[model samples]
Target: MKTKRRAAYFFTSLKLFLREYRLFVLLGCLCLLGGVVVGVLSARSFGEDYYKLNFIFELHSGSYSFAKTFFLALLFGWGGLALILLCGFNRWLIFPAFFLVAFLGYRLGLGFVGCLQPSGAGGVACVIFFYLPLYLTAGTVFIVYICMVFSSICGACGVFSSASSVKRLFFKALPLSLVFAAAAFFSCILIPLLYKLFFM
Candidate 1:
């Protein structure tokens, strides 16, 4: 009975959050779409030749270590920040959270373009098979963060009990963010192996 009651309460809170921030969610979706559009337009400049040339050089020259480290650091760092944002609420958190979402969306979009290319098909396959899940998890976490930010903003302006309730509501998202972050961290190890298999 206690477990059931807790589950019910969680669902109720989720529903209230969705209902309250529906517009902001829509805005986030639109921004993601815009990011994708920009990515597609920019894809023409990121030709297969450039990708193959650089990727081949990196494989032969051992410069890929820098890249692998950078990618892991970036993804893990973003995940960490998202997790932190999930447990707190501040009106000031909105811009950075949204920017992270937009940037990730744009990169994912570019990656999709790369996936569609014949030369990049194998790498894209790896991304689809492996990185896609991680990216989706990260995206979900960011969305939740944005929701928290919006909620905090409203709360700060008198919609609720100020920072206390905002903090309470935001912390409710912590479990999901932690789950996502773990998956992303584990997935990071696959990066070099996948690159070797696909590009090397």
Candidate 2:
């Protein structure tokens, strides 16, 4: 009964969020698409020689590469969540959060650009097997965080405004943070193992 109530609340909050923030989400997605378009267009200058470079393929090998990728995803996932929590208290942070969303979109775009590479099957495979699942999960979490922060900022200043608001925000943030943390965990372990299996 309690679990069902919690699920109901989650869905209610999500419905409200989507209705309220649809425009903002759409804008962010457009920015992400634009970044991807730019990344693909820019890759034209990279040339066949650039793709042919052995270092590009070789970099995917070794424990160092996997370690770096795992740590970076972990850092970004948790760090971004931390930032969202910090920003929730300050309305002034909305602009910066907007930019951060755009930047995340840009990085996603770059990943897509890598997959679109004409000659580098290794790069394509890396994007597909190693990066896509992690990014999709992490990126969804990021979008949720950004939207939550934005919503929190819009409501009231800081976490101490009211007892009800505090409780509400906590409940909302808890699931999103847990989901992102799970994504980070998987990105660290699952992504690396998959990378080794396919790429190595």
Candidate 3:
């Protein structure tokens, strides 16, 4: 009964948070999409030169390593969560959070282009099978963290205009962030295993 009550409260808090900060969430999504489009266009325009210019492309073009993929995904997930959590203390940190999301999206764009170059339809399938889950999980975590940070900043700035309100917002965001973090970490860990099973 206590567990059920806690679950109900969690859902209620989440619903209120979404309603209050939907615009910030939308902005986070747009930033990611915008970054992806830019990356795609840059790769298309620059071709081989772009591959040379971007170290991430070099990393992607190399042989696949389960250890490397696992580590990087772990870093992307938990590291991003850490960064977003820190952003709550200073508004300036928000810029880094935004950049991190956009940068991840850009990396995804470059990777998608690379996948298409050799395999065509098979490449698309590879992305759907392998990359999509990892990136989507990371992206969800990032968007939520970004929103939480933004909301915290607003609360600090008196946008919420009440100490109790600010505290309530923090409490709501804290558990949600932790939940997403765990999900991101597990999803990332699963990706390398999935790749090894199917692609390797």
Order candidates by lDDT, high to low: 3, 2, 1
lDDT of 1 at 117: 52
lDDT of each: 0.60, 0.62, 0.65
lDDT of 1 by residue, 1-200 (tens): 99999999999998987798887677777666777677767876755433432333345566655446446745564664544454344555565666666776776667666555534655565466544766666666667666765555545353244767656654656676566756555555555456678766
Worst 10 residues of 3 by lDDT: 50-59
TM-score of each: 0.61, 0.67, 0.67
Candidates 1 and 3 compared by TM-score, better number: 3
Q: Per-residue error at 2 for model 1, in Å?
A: 13
The RMSD of every model to the true structure, in order and in angstroms, is 5.7, 4.9, 5.8
Best by lDDT: 3
Error of 3 at 96 (Å): 2.1
Better-scoring candidate (lDDT), 1 or 3: 3
Worst 10 contiguous positions by lDDT, candidate 2: 47-56
